[model samples]
Target chain A: MQTETDLVTGPAPHWHEGVSIIDAMQDVLLALIPITITGILIFGTGALLVIITCVTGAVLGEIVARRFKGEQTNLGDGTAVVTGLLLALTLPPTAWWAVVPLYTLGGFLSVAIFREAMGGLGRNRFNPALMGRVFLLFGRTTLVYLAPYLIDFNPAFTPWLEELEVVDVMAKATPLLRVVEGMELPSYSTLLAIYEGGSPAETSALAVILGIIYLIYRGRISWRIPITTVTGVFLLSLFLGQDPLFQVLSGGLLFGVGFMATDWVTRPVTDTGKIIYGLGIAVLVVFFRQFIAELWIGYGGVAFSILIMNGFVRYIDKLTARRVYGQKK
Target chain B: MAEKTFRGGIHLPYFKDLSSGKEIERVPVPEEIIIPLKQSIGAACEPTVKPGEKVEAGDIVGDSEEFVSAPLHTGLPGVVKAIEPRITGTGSKIKSVIIKVDKNFSAAKPDKARNAEEVSKEEIIKAVRKAGIVGMGGAAFPTPVKLTPPDDKKVDTVIINGCECEPFLTCDYRVMLEKPKELLQGSKFLMQTMEADKCFIAIEENKMKAVNNLRKHNTFSNIDVLALPSIYPQGSEKQLIQAILDREVPEGGLPFDVGVLVQNVGTTVAIYDAVIYDKPLTERVVTVTGPNINKPANLLTWIGSPVKNLLEKCGGIKNKPARVVMGGPMTGTALSELDAPIVKSSLGLVVMTVEDSSLDVDDFRPCVRCERCIKACPIGLYPNYLSMAMEENNVVEAEKWDAMSCIECGICSYVCMSKRPIVYLIKKAKEKIQENKSD
Candidate 1:
């Protein structure tokens, strides 16, 4: 005989909207579209190769790492994709061929060492992509050794690069580097166009702005970090008697401020905490490059500043915690 | 009028349009009714009538000497079938009297006339205790118990919570429109009983027509009909007091601690019925609605009517209902079976589709540290950290994070992007803390 006891009983709330970790990660992926396209348009097939190789390597690393840790791994969540895309975008476009192997190793270290071992996605202490970029930049003689390989390279395989009018601009010792060497800077208005040089994504400031507008419009990302942090850097540059617009639009500051500092897990979650975190990143980036060091070793100041700030996220959260309505201090 | 509101709340889609337009229909007294003796917040009542005894409408069936409890009154004239354990809406089994209707059965008359002006404060309190009116806002605390606050703490304000902020429930809204006089007069009686300085009938902006109707009853100058923002948990006792009085009822404290008292509109009508007419609480308006329900409606039902009977009256269901919620979706108790009887505190019977029960547990993920829960918390407690503390099984850390301050409104869970059950974790931590204190 069978018993009649198959009814369902649960807790108070019986409804939830269709949102999950994968959905948020997917939204971030969608917001990166314009920047990714701008990178391909600026650096031709090199940017495409860097993105595909890093994304593929990072995703595979997450799968293999989680399997080894005996933990559940959801590959379709697009977190790995976001990490890979962001890592590739922050690197110099000239590293497209030579830096692929090093960055792919960096991607594996990111997922295996920083992310999965630190408890995956939301629990990870550092931004996996940024950590991977920092690892390649400082971990070894990789950048120092590979620096000469990109300088002498020809754009023979970049069939799309031959068709663009600004092909003359796609060389080593980028525009930002020329500024660091005390060379004359480009006009402020020209920062929005393709001839501007830094990383592949940083080549077009307009593309990054368009992507940021989407994030702000969709309410997917917070505006406090990008708005305050970028302004803080610009203000500091003005105080130092430097070109403020050049400080804001040039280098990886725009890309880093707009997206990287706003990652919900690694950054402070409170409104005030986010502003403080953003201002700190701005000061560190500008201070490291302008005061402490310059040239190639200091181009990495932004990523280093962000990773260091990630360590202080919990303290910032505690300090800025909202006072419970009627509790005594 | 501008809407009054507190900070930190979410605006969920108020699906009131499903049954807001439908007038409340009555469910005829069933052939057999199951009445739970423990209807209110306190001790269980002793059985007044035994098996094989005949009883009539408005007759006392069970009486408890406990000061925190209220008496139980029989609604249908019938012979006692049996007094035994029966299932209630919360899926808990309790002792209840099973009554079979007489051949010439007549239900209790709810239309007995009332003279609100003649009722004295002492008489009103006595009548409420005799009539067995519990809070119909779903808390089910006895009205007499709620009215009797400590002497040292002065009670100066009375707020009538007409803000039915729950989704898919509209019984309170319909009552405010159909019976504004009783709501106002009953509130006046409560104000006079408690010796409060002023009265506020707070309604959400979504029910502006109800607000206008209550405002038109200009006889009571002290009773002010105010509009509140339409947000989940806006009708919560503490939140209502916070928004109107600008006073916080401290952590782990009652609204009365802030010199305020809140009563549901349905309970106000019951209070009016009990005080003026010398009647007892036997029936209430239970909003029956949902997408799966074939005909959604605000239903005036007997307190002991089975949920299945009410659903059948509303044209049964369009599809297999996966869950039957007792109150509003935000804070209602989900039932295990449809046979559970609607008790005094059961405000609505919502028939949800199988899709609600089909939610996969695998979709739940790590807390993404999105401050959506923080932004949605009405009490300002940090739910994400409470969830984290509970995840790590550190109750001390949970307390430091003000886990005890959470009101269990379920808004955090409602607005969470990662589908984390933040409210559940808070409940767990609160229960653990309480257990530790007792130990």
Candidate 2:
């Protein structure tokens, strides 16, 4: 009985697949659960503290940035939370409690400067979490220089810093860093089980794989990026005469490939472009880990490689553009 | 044989259960009908009869001298009330012949069935044109125009499209199931007219009953029943040719360029009716069903019946519909009002409830660059890049991204997580690009 005047009119395809941006973001957050739990179990309260601080900082940063821009806040989309979780997973758990503020700063930088200022969410040129981590990497020297001054200025910071040193025993040089130093490697089972050396999320390869499976099953991420990235690293490690399994399992390679490198907005949109981007990230990671690890301790090669590849996403998309149907090859 | 399908189509939830099992029944003649003079893609026909003229059933009421157009005939013997502008299902107001039907008038049956085997190609073409038959699969391209491909192009294969890949509509399925022999005969008539060597009756695997029925009734060795994968837009002319023939119709080219001609199965049945029964196209099978439809059904409807009458005949609306779409859900026209009369290309009347029509048209989010649209594009065009270009209103960028090649299947918009109106933007860009070219 409703007349046309009372009804709403839209373009064709009045129905949708019912998958919204919120749904996809929620699926990603769900996929990240296994690694977060594993990180907490392995590194205890320190990992938990880093995650809580980073997520809180990122959410607050997003709200502040949106309010500043006169835009409605979209924190319900869960993108800021995902960015915060990814940034926390990329940090060393045994770092000084000063890392709490630094990690929070990284989260703030991710949503505010890297994401919101660059046009928010999908408009960002680089992976926000990786940009945040890279910013911290660049500022690490300043942090070292100010550490003693900050300790002298605040006596309360001394006990938290000393407590971090006790936890530092469990976080030694990562397997890839040890390979660069020509030290003995952990067994493959131990590495897959709970090898603690690098960032918090890198402690359990099994956990990352579980997350990857969940993401793939949920259709949240494509297999081309993660599979090609791991394959490229394994093959490149074999070419470099390093243990391929160690190269695949060590550092933040799996976690970064599964989560950060495959960030939907920053990565290439085409399938072939994704493969090229993944391989390019792998090449850079192996090259940097092999040659640059000796220069900088705890070198975050995966983050650097992915960030570099992020820069080439537009070019990759252009170069690997699909031949439109019926067009001559 | 393995089922065939083209790449880059989405798996849609085919809500065919709403009306697929219902048998086709004829709607009672309404008191008045408004036959649009132009129903197809080509030129609109001029009114052959003046106002207040008495016209018999199957009498040509509108005709044009244009070769690309078809004549319009009235289904019920009636008095022409007026020749005035009226809104059609496409939301366009064209000059229509509004006829007040005589309640006691019933159409006289044909004298005898003509021997289809003895009918020559030229005769069949002439009969098809005279009968005002057009493609009923919703394109409404004149059958005579399609039958007469350019002399330079050799159309060696005829693909009878029965895929009916659009969700919530099964008029074609019911047609095939109810009129299997006639469909095959009509396909043969099409093959004979086109001088094509072989014919393929392509049905989606979901409609296996129609497929099996057609297969069992097929008497010609040259014709094969092919069950294709049930993917949205699988029934698209270009995609159909690609799936069955593995040959891409050249860019900006017709199916004739690839030596193929695809005709909808319903059109084939019309062809049979035109050729054998010596009848003009006055009625068609339209699926009248949706979540809001109280008694969903496939109704044999007259050409110019108001959509309101059809819905009423289907037991009326159970609740207020969110959208009343004419044709398939994917590429159908959303009717602005129930007063619009059904034209030749209307495949069905789908009344979607709020739960079924879930798109929040105003809540557009930023593109996450998910590439689901790109992967879902049947034409393999980069919809993401094209959408961006269109958003900026850059005609040159849209052209560079092959915006013109987009098929407007709405899969890109359907699969978009951001729910961007991607096809709508591409259509706007294409229109602007055409305007620029003309300027």
| TM-score top scorer | 2
What's the lDDT for candidate 2?
0.86
Cα misplacement distance, residue A324 of candidate 2 (Å) = 1.6
lDDT of 2 by residue, A1-329 (tens): 55666555788787888787888888888878888888777777778778887888799889999999988898888889989998888777644566778778889989999999987878888999988888876666576676656423244656545444334622377777677677888889978988877677788899889888888898788999999999999999899998888889888889999999889899998889999999999999888877777764454788889988999998898899888988997
Q: What is the Cα root-mean-square deviation between model 1 and the actual structure?
A: 3.3
lDDT of 2 at A118: 88
lDDT of 1 at B122: 89
lDDT of each: 0.80, 0.86
Per-residue lDDT of B1-439 in model 1, one digit per residue for the tens? 4456776887778889999999877886687778888888889898899999998888888889889988887777889999999988767898998888774865445576656767788899999988998999989899998888888777899999999988888999999999998899899998999899799999999999999998988488888998888877899888888789888888777778889999999999999888878888888998989877888888888778788888888887676535778888778887877778888999898877767643333346778787778878888877888887787889999988888888888888877777777787788899999999999
Off by over 4 Å in 2: A151-166, A169-171, A179-185, A296-299
User: What's every prediction's RMSD, in angstroms?
Assistant: 3.3, 2.3
DockQ of 1: 0.49
Error of 1 at A318 (Å): 1.5
Per-prediction TM-score, please? Answer: 0.92, 0.95
lDDT of 2 at B81: 98
